[model samples]
Target: MDTRTRFAVSAALTLGLLAGCGDDAAPAGSAAGDPAPQATGEPWYDEVTPASASGTTGGAGSPCPVPVSFPLADGWTAKAIEPPKGELAELLGEALTKRGGTTARCEVDGRPAGGGFLRVWAADTPTVAPRAALEGFAAGSGETVSGQQFRDLRAGSFDVTEMTWLATNPLAEEEAARNWALAVQSAGQTLVFAVNEGLITERTDVLPAYRLAVRGLAAPG
Candidate 1:
């Protein structure tokens, strides 16, 4: 698979991992004192050092377990779809911690002529650091990633790495051009904030909202 496919597949897998969590999830690989999932050889970031990471409350009475949240901008609307299951679940569940993750999708500009959806995936894993997971997914078969560098940035009190990539259609025969996925990862979870350039003509117009979404995500206080 190409890097593009790796990116999308990894995101989907993260979501699937989230859907697999039972109320009684153990810390990834402690069952038999053995590593449950195969290792990808990716290096982990430094441990989460801060005593408190910034986060927002789930409104007054909302019940979603995800610690982070994203905003729905003017042209955006939430998507309602059943979570992944069965063999699909088995496939995506492997690389992630059994503790699972969370996903949210929204249509942009009501999905106008060229508009698409902005999707975010956040997963909590005992074994994988947010940066390592992001790097692992960004690694595609044998292709080289060009023109981008990972940088340290802060989202509220949470320290994160910001990585940008040219989004492409994974299923296309040739890597067809798409928008962009401005992904940020904190110590506890990975968040992907995507934008469809085809749908929204001016990238600048949507950046502020995207930045706000990133800042809004916070681990439990």
Candidate 2:
């Protein structure tokens, strides 16, 4: 199978597990361990951190437009993308294609982890999401749902439902979770979409920041 196919399968499996937790109230993965350190004010992932010695760049911001109407924890920065086509998914696909990756839209789960369909881009060559790309990461990445709420948002002429997930990062669990959120909007035949890595992790310290970011999202008219 191709890399995209593999990602699809992995994403599906991961989402499936997340979907099974309905009203459990205990939060997924809490049993794995105690929460990590709580970030003060805004976490580093909310802002751009310079690259570390391991060569991993820290705190990359999304390429979406600035002053985008989304909730943010104190100190977190949010950017918005003004797509040329006015459709987020299409714009994301075009951006990925420009960077040598192939893109497609697929049905996503919309329950515990904020299930719904979303567009995913895959690349055999190096590519990055608009946010990561602007930050100079050379890796193939895509955005998907990962949290418990489906938020309605408006961007440009699109109406979108956004979801978040606590992404797992073996090395920087807190930082990873603080940076991921999946936002999707339907614009005619296309879905305007955005995903952040800071909000997609299982760290406790990051959950508050993730919640703050979710609260910051504004419905686009």
Model 1 lDDT tens row, 1-221:
45455556535533433321322232232232231222121111112121122233332132233345544444444432234567876555443322123344222222432223444544344345555544544443123433333444556555555444334444455443323343454444465545433322434444434455555556544
| 10 residues in a row with least lDDT, candidate 1 | 41-50
TM-scores of all models?
0.46, 0.27
What overall lDDT goes with each candidate model?
Answer: 0.40, 0.30
lDDT of 2 by residue, 62-138 (tens): 32222223333333322222223446645443443332233322222222333222222222222233323222121
RMSD of every prediction: 13.7, 15.8
Alpha carbon lDDT at 89, candidate 1: 64
Q: What is the lDDT of residue 48 in candidate 1?
A: 13
**Model 2 lowest lDDT segment of ten:** 49-58
28 Cα displacement, candidate 2 (Å) = 13
Return the top candidate by lDDT.
1
